[model samples]
Target: MDDNRTDKVLLYKGVKTMIFAVLTLFMGPIILSMALSQPENKLYIPLLVVGLLICAFAVFLIFKGIRLIMNSMFKK
Candidate 1:
């Protein structure tokens, strides 16, 4: 790969990783607050489950981005 293309790829992966990390951090508090605020509501369970899934997806995205960056750096 050319230097320009490699730099762009690295930048994209880094940015994507940061975005996923931010989403995970942001969603955690929102999910907790929602669960705590509506303890009596039966819907909270579903909401919590959905929130957990979203967080998990964000984490997966983060790992994927990291893997891409690492592969780019170390590939023979």
Candidate 2:
């Protein structure tokens, strides 16, 4: 019999990563907007940089999560 069962542990990890990525996605835009609204602030540049980095990280996390979920479902 071919046992093609999904790996629950990896699937769970992927779900968790996706959730975190969603939160980061929201946070990045909020931070970027806040920084844009206060261009004169000394922390504006740093906040903008951080926001961009967070946005990039969210994208990475999304890709990673999808890959993990796919692996869990398809890998032996």
Candidate 3:
């Protein structure tokens, strides 16, 4: 990649990770609320599962971003 494209990608990646973190933080409480509101029929299970999946995906992306930054730093 060209130098400008590489720099842009790195900046965009940091922004993406921050956005992902914010989304996870915001969704977590809402999901937990939905899960807790209904108790008898085990309604929370599906919500919990989906929420965890999303959170895991976000975390994975964040880690990938960090690794990319580290690799670039070391390469430079």
Candidate 4:
């Protein structure tokens, strides 16, 4: 196997993770806002919970992506 292949793979994985993280982070708030814009009170709690979960997962993704990127860069 070529030495650079692993580096490329890691880089690609990190980039994909970052992209997904950004989407998750932004979409969560946007969705929550849209949901709250409605006058109906029935779905508030559920939407809030789901939004928070999305945000939390986004954070985890962000951290994992950063870690993967750093590992790739420092790998010998």
Candidate 5:
């Protein structure tokens, strides 16, 4: 017989990561928009770069969260 059970800790971690990712995803666009709205501002370039990095990190976190969740559910 095989023992198959979900790893609660991993699932929780994954859920946490997903939540963070979602927040980052929303923030990225907002930051980018802010940066765009002030093209002449000294902070524009830095904000743009930070926004882009946040967006990329959000994507990475999403994938990582999914993988963690999948592993929690499927791995033995």
Candidate 6:
């Protein structure tokens, strides 16, 4: 309804969208590398798990931001 909410929506969609998307995207490489490597490599399990978890969390954040933007758009 005002400039403050407009600014919030802009920041939400512009900054947060890119940040979360990039974080989630990078997780794929980490997960893939672990899967392709020897099973016994010490870091594989933890890295793979943590990477997937972070990816999931980032994706959730991205979705939440998208919902915020969408709701804001429809309200206008």
Q: TM-score of the candidate numbered 5? A: 0.95
Between candidates 1 and 6, which one is better according to TM-score? 1
Candidate 6 lDDT by residue in tens digits, 1-76: 4453454656567567767678777876668677558678887777777767777877777777776676655554
Q: In candidate 3, where is summed lDDT lowest over 10 consecutive residues?
A: 2-11
Candidate 6 Cα lDDT to native = 0.69
Q: In angstroms, how far off is 73's CA in candidate 1? A: 2.0
> What lDDT tens digits, residue by residue, belong to model 3 across residues 1-76?
6452345567567667767777886787678677777866576788878777777777777777776666554446
Tens digits of lDDT, candidate 1, 1-76:
5453355677577777867778787897688679868979998888888778777877777777777776666554
Taking all chains together, each candidate's TM-score versus the true structure is: 0.65, 0.95, 0.61, 0.81, 0.95, 0.59
lDDT per model vs. reference: 0.75, 0.97, 0.70, 0.86, 0.97, 0.69
lDDT for model 2, please.
0.97
Question: Is 2 or 6 the stronger prediction by TM-score?
Answer: 2
1-76, model 5: which lDDT tens digit per residue? 9879999999999999999999999999999999999999999999999999999999999999999999999984
Q: Record all residue pairs in model 5 with backbone atoms less than 3 Å apart, i.e. clashing.
A: none
Q: What local lDDT does model 2 show for residue 54?
A: 97
Off by over 4 Å in 6: 1-15
Q: Please, what are the lDDT tens digits per residue for candidate 4 over residues 16-45? A: 999999999998997689677874888877
Angstrom error of the Cα, residue 71, model 1: value is 1.8
* CA deviation > 4 Å runs, candidate 5: none
Q: Which scores better on TM-score, 1 or 3?
A: 1
- lDDT digits (tens) for residues 1-76 of candidate 2: 8879999999999999999999999999999999999999999999999999999999999999999999999985
